[model samples]
Target: MRLTIERGALLKALGHVQNVVERRNTIPILSNVLIEAHDGSVTFAATDLDIEIIDGAEADVERAGAITVPAHLLYEIVRKLPDGAQVRLDLSSDDPRVTVTAGRGRFNLPVLAAGDFPAMSSGTFDTRFSLERSALARLIDRTRFAISTEETRYYLNGVYLHSATGDSGLALRAVATDGHRLALADHPQPEGTTPVSGVIIPRKTVQELRRLLEDAGEEVEIAVSEAKIQFSFGRTTLTSKLIDGTFPDYTRVIPKGNSRVMTVRNDEFSRAVDRVATMAAERSRSIKLTVGDSKVVLAVNSPETGAATEEVEADYKSETIEIGFNAKYLLDISSQIGTGEARFEFADAASPTLVRDGNDPNALFVLMPLRV
Candidate 1:
């Protein structure tokens, strides 16, 4: 098999697919990328048995054939080649190696039989739909910070993606939590989407999908079955196995009747929290908020470390309330509010606090208070 591909194009395709190959492998074939040449294009594929990515790019195919090569090695060689140089790849038995040649450089790499690679099942999807890339990105960015990293509660490791009838109407919602804080966001459900059982997208899949959607303006085609989910965009396709656990009922975690309300500038609140947290204990990271009389003061005190206090102007008209919260949690929730303003609704000092963007009702956050 022989082919010539522009270095830039080859590097881009490899970058998209090679990340799935783990640096350490128990199986030899799993460490290599399956490269197939046919028609006028070359396809690169890599997988970790759980998730797979395939990317195709246009190339000059002299002899159509396939081979497997170390994904990371090929990527590095192509990436280091001169900018617009054309990369020539030849698989010949005389040398018993795959030859990669560019401007003034040439390297020989060992190859594996493509037949040894495991095949990813193209399972029948019970539901398929199309969504705007920007919309999907919004849903993920808003809630991913709250996804639990704890492995024991496998159910909480991914975002809960499903269809729901929100106050605004039918919507596609994403929710994630780690028992300390919860994030919930909704987008308009795409047309002709049939309701299916909720699927918990593992955290790793969310991150990769997010990267794929970056700077993408085209609509993304999605297919979901009971066991797997697939995303197709441009010349790339990603398939991932769904977490085989049930997501807990998240609606119960969101407070329904938190009456006390406080409105503050998002940036101001974040800055105040950051300053007060400087003196907070490294382990606890707790900061106290004193709310009253159209103003709120943030304070943190540690026995061995010292204390910090900062005041910020706010529009708090409800009964004075004091609450304790983890500084990092406050910053995470505040950073998500796109609008310059943020609203906090509280039931009391001991209950969960609801945080929302003053301009966007479709997204909100619920954070449990810390004992201070």
Candidate 2:
């Protein structure tokens, strides 16, 4: 195997694939990236069984061949090289050692036979759709924080993504909840359906895809199958196995008939919660919301940690009511509100309250109250 690839290009390809390699592996080949030099391009493929990523870049191909080498070490070598240096790699012998050379620095790293590398099954997706990278990023960032870490409910470990018929017809919706809090984010358009059922996008895929979507504004081609899903952008394609479980009916848990409404500036409300909650005990740091005719007060009190309260000028016209909620949960939900203002609709301290960003009547978020 022989190829000369630019130092920067090789490093960028390795950067995306290296993360899929496990730090500790029972199968040594699993720690290595399969490097294939064919035609006029080179490709790097790495996998952890559950997820696999393939990245291809243009390179000067001399002798077409393939080999497996330590992913992290190769990444480090190319990353440290001077800019514009050509990275020359060659493997000419049966018992191969990859020779890497760049200017004054050169090294030979032991290689594994490419035959031992694991292969990921290409999923047969029944339904496939395309979406803007920005749209997917927004959907993930808004709801991922609520994905449950509980092992017992294996289904909740990933975000539930599906097409729902909302007030404005079909919409792409994503939801996550760890019991204490829930996040629901959706986009009004760019939604379709197929025979294959909804799939739970694992947490790791969510994070990796987010990193990839950062520099992309183009539409991402997504293909989904019964057992796996694929996301393709530019020269990279990520394939991941779907978690096997059924997500609970989240909509049924959302409360209705919450008529008491309060409106406040998003930034001001978040700051007030942070300030008051600082003095509350860690075990039960619940913030009590007191609503009146035209004002709202946030109070947090812990006999051991002392008490703090801050008031925000709000637009409210409901019976004076007090409701308690986990301060941290409130802060998380508030942070994702994209608008300058947030609306909270409350029935009482015992009912779940709906929160929405600004006056977007299409999207609604519900949070179950806590006992302070």
Candidate 3:
């Protein structure tokens, strides 16, 4: 196999696919990337059994063939090469190694048979849809923070994506929770999308997909089946397996009868919580909020550290209420509120509190109170 590709183009393709390859692999071929050079283009593919990524770039092909090489090693070599230099990869039929040449630098890397690289087979998709990049990004950004990392309750380790009936009509929703907090976001369902059963996209897949979307075009094509999901972005494609466990009914945890409401500027509230949290205990990181009239006071007390208090103006007319919460959880939810006002509904200090973004009615958050 022989091909010449621009340094920048080759680096971009390698950077996208190499991340899916794990640093340590029990199987030899799993640690390498499969490179296929044909016609006028070259494709790079890498996988770790559960998730696979493929990226392609145009190249000047002298002899068309396929080979596999160390993914990270090849990526670093191309990344450090001169910016505009042309890179040539050559592998003769009798040679067992591939030679990389750029300018005066030459390096030989061992090769593995391309046929040994496992390809993730995507079975027939039951649902297919298209979503604008911005819309899909919004759904992910607002809810991913709450995805649980606990392995025992594997169902909560990913974002639950499905179709639901919203205030306006049919909506595509993303929900994630870690028991202490939950985040839910919605977007209008695309016109021709078929209804699909809810799917739990694993955490790693969600993260890799988010990174790919950063450079994606205006629209992304999505295909979903019972056991797998695929996202196609022009020359790149990502296929991942769906988690098998069933996610709990999240609606039961979202409080519905909270009567007390307090509205405060998100930025101001976030800053106040951050300041008082410095004195909180390392394990709990608990902060208490005293709300009444048109103001709220945040306080943190730790036996080993110290105590701190800060007051912020708010819009509230209900009876006085005191609630305790984890300072980090509060900040995570506040950041998602953007620069708008944060509305909090309380039903005393023992029940869960509902939070919403004033500027975006499609997003919601629920936080469980701690015993202060």
Candidate 4:
């Protein structure tokens, strides 16, 4: 394989695919990226058995062939090259080395045969849909923070994506929960698409999909099946296996009878939580919230450390209520409220609290109170 590609173009393409290759791999080919030079373009593909990314960039191809080389090494070489410099790559089957030349610098990287790379099988997709990039971005951003990091409850380790009847008729919903808290967001279902089956998109793939959609154009194409999911946009494609566990029924967790409503400035509440949390113990990090008529107090106490209290103006008119929660969870859900104001509904000190942006039907969060 021989090709001449702009340093910026090559670096950008490598940036998309190389991260999928693990630094330490038991299989030799899994650590390398398959580079193919074809008619007027070059493609880079890398996979870690579960997830695969393929990126194509325009290049001047001198010879049509393919080679697999160290993904990180090639990325570093192109990244360090002077801006606007042209990079040339040459590799032949006889010599198991790839020659990379930019300006006056040269480097030879060991290569593996492209035929050794494992192919990812993306089975037939039962649901296909396309939506605005911003819509999906909002859904991911609103719920991804709530994904559980625990491996034992593998079902909670990813964002649950499915179709639901939301405030806006049929909607595409994403929900994630870590037992302690939950986040749910929805977008209007796109036209000309079949309803999507409930699937758990693993955290890693959710992260990669977020990165891929960073500077994406107007729309993104998605294909989903029981076992796999694929995202295609521009000149790149990402295929990932869906987590094979069933997500718990999240609807039952959301409280519908929490009538006591409290509204507060989003930034003010977040800042108060952060300040009071400093005095909390590293283990619990529990903060207590006291809601009184038109006022809210946030306080935290740790035996090893001191105590902190902050008073924030709120619009609470119900009976006095006291609730304890992890400061991190409060801040996370509050930060997702794009509106300046956030509304919280409480059933009692022990029942889960419901939170949402004032009058925004697109997203909601629930936090299970802690005993202080």
Candidate 5:
């Protein structure tokens, strides 16, 4: 393959696809990227068997052909080249190496047959939909922090995405939990969206997709089946295998009759918790919340680190209640509350507590209290 492309354009495409290639691989071809030049553009594809990413850039094609080369090495070489430099790639049928030329620098990289690269087959999609980029970003940011990292509960290691009925009617929801904390966020269902069964999008796939969305256009196309899911950005596409397991019914854990309510300034509450948590034990990181008539006291006591306390003004009229919660979990949920005020509903010190944004009714969080 012989083609010429701008250094910035080539580097951007490489940056997108090379991340999917594992640093170490048992199969030689799995460590390489498949590069193809044809139809006035060049495409770079890389995969780690479970996930595949393909990105393309416009280029000057001298001759149409394809080849495979070390993904990271090529990326580094092109990245170090001068900005706006023209990069030329040349490969001959009989040669076992591909020559890369930029400015006065030239390098030869070992090549592999393009046919040896594996491709993740995209089966027929049972449901296809389109979502505004901002909408999808909101759903991921609000819930992904709660995704479980425990390996045994494989099903909980991803966000549960499905259709459900919300206060506004039909909605698309994303829910994630790690047993200690749960986060749920919803967006109004898009027009012409086909109802789909709940699917577990693995953590790694969610992270990669999030990175791609940062530079994606206004709209994104999504296709889903029982086995795989695909996201198509303008000049880039990502295909990933869905986790093969059933997520537990999350509704069972959400409390239904918590009537006690406390409304506090989110910024004030977060800062207070952070200050008191400095004295919390390393293992438990537990902080106690003493809610009273119109104020809340945040305290942390550790045998090794001593004790710390802070009082934050709040709007609460219920019976005084003292609850214990992980300081990190509290801060994480608090960050997702978009409004200035954060509302918390509690049943008792021993029961799960419900938290919500004062302004955004579409998002909610549940925190399991710890024994302080």
Candidate 6:
């Protein structure tokens, strides 16, 4: 393809799609990106068979054509080019080599057969909705830490999204659990859009897309079918096949009847947990909590190692209770609280604990207790 594009624009476009391409591939075409120039615009697409990303950028196309070229090499070359420089690309032969020239630099990169590249199927998705990337970002940020890495329980390996009657009438909820703890966050649904059908989005897609949308506040269109899902943003699109297994029922694990309430500064509690947990041996990074009338004691003891205790005065008048939690889990929830006060609800030492910001019933968190 022959096209002239701004270096910044091309790099930004490639940055979005090239990440979907793997560094190493068993098949030749899988390691390349399909570049198409047409109607004064250029598009780049890459995939690893499971996930695909397509990005389009404005350019000057002298001759409309398509070719497949090494994605990483192109990214590096375009990245190193002078800022604001314009780039011109043209095909050198039917063998698919591409001649790239910009300012005072010129190089021909070996290419693969564009015909060999796997095409992304545009399947009909049943559920369609548009959500603010910011809201989705909050949901993802709040729950991603709890995602399970254990491969055997594939069902719990991603975030569970579904329709729920939350504090707000109809809500979009995201939940992640690794058996030790669970992170749940809820937000109001947009007008005319029903709640998202209960589905488990794989961890890889969740994480990759989360990083992409961090600074993005635009509205994102989402389409979900029986076995696949698609995300459409400004000039980029992501399509992935959903995980095949079922996600375990998460509602049952949430402790609803916890009556004893504890309110603490999010930063303070997280700091105490982090400091005390350090003294815990690697095997058991456990932090024990002793709740009293007006004080809370954070303590950790490793038999082979030393012990640590921190007294953080709390506004608690409930019955005295001792509970144990994985320090990592507590730290995760507290960090996400971000500039807000957090509350903990407990029924007993053996029951799960419900945590959230003060009076913000919509955003909730649950942590299962650890026996110390």
Please list the C-alpha lDDT of all candidates, in the order they appear: 0.91, 0.85, 0.95, 0.92, 0.94, 0.86
Candidate no. 3 TM-score? 0.98
The residue-level lDDT of candidate 3 at 136 comes to 88
Candidate 1, residues 67-176: lDDT per residue as tens digits? 99999999999988889999999998676789999987989999999989886897799999988888889999999999999999999999999999887888989999
TM-score of each: 0.98, 0.94, 0.98, 0.98, 0.98, 0.95
Query: What are the clash counts of all predictions, listed in order?
Result: 0, 1, 0, 0, 0, 0
Tens digits of per-residue lDDT for model 2, 1-372: 889999989988999889888899998999999999999999999998888999889999999999999999999889999999999998987646999989889889989989999889794777787888878888898888888888888889888888777777777888888876777876765645453357898888888778878655488988888788899988899999988999888888677777888989989889898999898789877889888977889897788988788888999987899889888888888888854789998887888888888845555667879887
Whichever of 1 and 6 has more lDDT, that candidate is: 1
Model 4 regions more than 4 Å off: none
lDDT of 3 by residue, 1-372 (tens): 999999999999998889988999999999999999999999999999999999999999999999999999999999999899999999998879999999999999999999998999888999999999889899999999999999999999999999998777899999999999999998998998897579999999999999989989999999999999999988999999999999999999999999899999999999999999999999999999999899999998888998999999999999999999999999999999978899999999999999999999999999999999
CA lDDT of 179 in candidate 6? 92
Please list the residue runs of candidate 1 whose C-alpha ends up more than 4 Å from where it truly belongs after superposition: none
Residues 121-180, candidate 6: write the lDDT tens digits: 978988899889988888898888999999999988888888788876888888999998
Model 6 TM? 0.95
lDDT of 3 at 107: 96
- Against the true structure, what is every candidate's RMSD? 1.1, 1.9, 0.9, 0.9, 1.1, 1.6
Estimate the lDDT of model 1: 0.91
lDDT of 4 by residue, 39-90 (tens): 9999999999999999999999999999899999899989999999999998
Which model is ahead, 2 or 3, in terms of lDDT?
A: 3
lDDT of candidate 3 at residue 14, scale 0 to 100: 93
Clashes of 6: 0
Clash pairs, candidate 2, are 125-224
